[model samples]
Target chain A: MTTLSVRNLRTHFFTKEGVAKAVDGVDFDVAPGEILGLVGESGSGKTVTGFSILGLIDPPGRIVEGSSIRFNGEELTAARPERLRAIRGSEIAMIFQDPMMTLNPVLRVDTQMIETVQAHLKVSEADARDRARKALVQVGIPSPDERLRAYPHQFSGGMRQRVAIAIALLHKPKLIVADEPTTALDVTIQGQILFEVQRLCRESGTAMIWVTHDLAVVAGLADRIAVMYAGRIVETGRTADVIERPMHPYTKGLIGSVPSQNTRGHKLAQIPGMTPSLLRLPRGCAFKARCPIAIDQCNEMPALEEHRPGHWARCWRATG
Target chain B: MIVYIIRRLMQAALVMVVMSVLVFAGIYLIGDPVLMMISPDASELEREAVRKALHLDLPMWQQYLLFVNDALHGNFGKSFLAGQPAMGLIFERFPATLELAFASLVLSLAIGLPLGVYAGLRPHTAGSKTIMTGSILGFSLPNFWVGLMLIMVFAVLLPDLVPGWPRLPASGRGATVDVLGVKLSFLTGDGLLHLLLPAVTLSLYKGALIVRLARATAREVLPMDYVKFARAKGLSERRIVGVHVLKNIMIPIATVSGLEFGQTVAFAVVTETIFSWPGVGKLLIDSILLLDRPVVVAYLVIIVFFFVALNLVVDLLYSVLDPRVRLESRAT
Candidate 1:
């Protein structure tokens, strides 16, 4: 069953210069126990889309129109603050890139995690503490009980991120949104976190949205992948198909830019030119200026269409 | 932690010593003590007695030694004007000023913190804009003007406009009230009623400072990846502000609070003059006008001490607020 469906999401920021279409009309779904990777470069609106789904955008930046977010058939787009509060932490959890941001500097790890559990569930402090300890253990934290008493500052960067992950897993939410949760950690720790997250999701039947810019990380972990550019998804499909048989020119360029794909000592293939400003986006296809396969008709915006079974691309030439 | 405390105390001592030297030098630079005592019309015997009384006959180093020795033994000598022990005078006045300073600090925190959090959470909303504009006005207005305005509105205008409008006392301690068979005087017990106007006047400047600090700190903390993660975890906005934002914002708030506390003490001079409140500010002004050298020196020392002590407390709070700070210090 579909655990979360975000249809035609649009988010924008109002500034003195003009409106910045950060997330302009995007769609995706996460099924039970499935891992969906939303991949994009910086300012591609990937983060904004994640934030919009969570209703986390501050003023000046707002969810404009055409957003219908549903979880288990419950409409979230219009969920009241109280209802959303009830659903958050209990049914949906998110892990962030920086662990310090998750952990309060003045509060002990145990105090924070226990409070997080007690906020949603009515249980004794001891019981909440037990759950927090168990969560720390599950996330591969060493000396769980002792570590719980330690502050975020006592832990290393990697350990702090693990603690953050532990806090997110404490409630066993049905859906988790991890936005670059391990991007700031070392490779070994990142692998460990990814392993734990994947195992937990599969065992608990928890749907996850893993937003990242690292294709390799998604290649190993995500069941499906969506490639975003200039506030829209250019291509999406099963991870294997998207990586092996990329149809969109932007997707091809992204694949080409990977350093591991190049021969030893050879100059790495890089997508040239900066991402166009969302405030003054190109009149035609946002990627036309950088697309190697650009043609006369490429000047027109192309709809995201199915190129093959479960494989979608937003290029008229690709469809032909 | 102990080592850090010891280091800080040593630094504080160094500062105090430097301050004493500067204070003594400032008094000395004003004029020749011998010439002041031996005016043209003064008799030789009277001049000699005055010189002996001030220890002007001793060397500068010996005089400073005598001053420090007397200071250490809690004897600041007699005030040149009042002819009473300076230390005794300062102690008698300390409680009143301390009470006012604390009351004002509490008032500022209570009003400024919540307003700042709200403004930060919704930067461009009508409510936030209104608060921001009001705070800016509060910050720009002089404390004396605010004091006058408050007194006019509460003490003058309201009493005339309404029959039996409570008349605020011009000076002296507040009235005593009987509650639950207990005689409680605000001036002696709670101090809240007597503290109202002065606290408000003092808090206006501090409140403005705190609001700006809180807003800036909260805004910086709110966008951190963890805050978004907390929201994703389903924490309410209130929880986020109280637990997450407030805790993170404390370092900046502590700094602003400490500085403002010292500022309010200094500002109490004007506040005391306006309200005629008998606190250290009034004592300092009286001593200055009367040329009470010992009283002036003693008050300056006490003010310096309060400033130093406030900074020490703020420093200690840093470790409590961010444990990583302790860890980093230990590591170093």
Candidate 2:
């Protein structure tokens, strides 16, 4: 079953400079127990997409009127604040990139985790704390009882992320929007967290959308991958297909930018030029200005087209 | 934690010692207290007798030693005007000053926190802009002038239109029973009325300070990732701000309040003089005019001690507000 289906999602910011389309038209889905990696660079709006899924966007930046977010067949486009609050952290939860952000620094881990549980549940404080402890143990944190008494700063970065993951799993929500939960950790910690998270999804049948800029992490972890650029998905398919046969040039540039053992002592292939300011993106395909295979029709906005059964690309020049 | 407090107390003592020396020397540099204390037509013999009694005949260092020796025993000599121990006089008035300082603090926190939170929650809105502008005016105008203006409006002019509150005494420690024939004591209905204007005038600037500080800190905290995370947790706007944003901004608030409290206690001279309130600040100004060196020096020393104590309070407050600080202190 589809857990989340965001269609024509458009979030923009009205700043003094101009309207920056942070998350323009976008569409994607996550099925039960399947992990969809929303891979993009810093400004491609992957984080905004995650925030928009939870209705967490603030003022000056808004999810425009026409956007529709359907989760488990319930319309969330014009969902009231009360409805969204009821759904969030119970039916759907989000784990931020920074675990410190997930936990209040001044509060005890147990207090924070228990409160997170009680925010959506009517359980007693002791019962909530027990669930928090269990969740920590599930996330591979040992000495759950002692660790629960500590603050966020007491835990290392890796451990803190695990605590955050534990908080996300407190209710075993149907969907979790994890925005680069392991991006801040070292590689070994990253690998460990990735394995635990992937296993958690598999065992619990919880659908997840892991947003990250690290292609390597997504390549190894995600069942499916979506490559976003300039506030739109440029290419998406099975993780192996997207990695092996990148159809869009921006995807190719991203894959090439990765430092490989195969290219020892050689210069890395970098995507030339900076990302266009979201406020002043060109009046055409946003990536067309940098596309090596650009054509006259590339000046027009390209619809996301299904080039194969499950693979998709939004470039006019993409072909089998 | 005990060691930390002990260290702080020792540091406070050292600071007081250094400040006493400075204040003692500094007041003497201003003028001779004997000249101000004695009449111009006083006989030379009487002047000499007064000088000898005050130990002015001795050198400055010896006199400082004598002053310290006497001060250690809580004997700040005598207020030449009051003909009483200066330390005793200060103690008598400390409660009145404490009342004003604490009341102003309570008023500022009560008013400033909400005003600032509102200004921060909705920046650039019409109401927020008005508050910001009003706060700026509060900050710019001197308290003495504001006090006088308040007196003119409420005490001098408002009586013509209104009957009850119009008779509010503009400048006095205690109120008279003539207004509406209701007897009001220093600790009762009239007492609070007497406190209202002076406290408001005194608190206005610091209250404005608290407002701006709260607004700036709250504004900075609103965009924090943790705050955003709280919102995403399905917490209501009120809960997120009250639980997450308020606590995060509390360190700055505590620091500002502590400093402002110390300042109010030490520097309420202008407001007290304008309103003729019976506070230590009024006593200090009077002592300065009379060149009562002991009283002035003793007041300065007490203020220094207050600042040190306030510093300690602020540190403790920081630890309370942020567990991170407490953990660090424990580690040390």
- Worst 10-residue lDDT window for candidate 2 chain B reads B176-185
Model 2: per-residue lDDT, tens digit, A32-65? 9999999999999999999899988887899999
The number of clashing residue pairs in each candidate reads: 4, 0
TM-score of chain B of each: 0.88, 0.91
lDDT of 2 by residue, B162-224 (tens): 676557676666743433433333466777889888989988988898899899989998887
> What C-alpha lDDT, on a 0 to 100 scale, does residue A308 get in candidate 1?
89
Q: Candidate 1: lDDT of B80?
A: 67
DockQ of each: 0.64, 0.65
What are the runs in model 1 whose C-alpha is more than 4 Å off? A14-16, A265-267, B29-44, B53-56, B175-193, B327-332
TM-score for candidate 2:
0.93
Give each model a TM-score: 0.90, 0.93
User: Which residue pairs in model 1 clash with each other?
Assistant: A88-B234, A89-B233, A89-B234, A101-B226
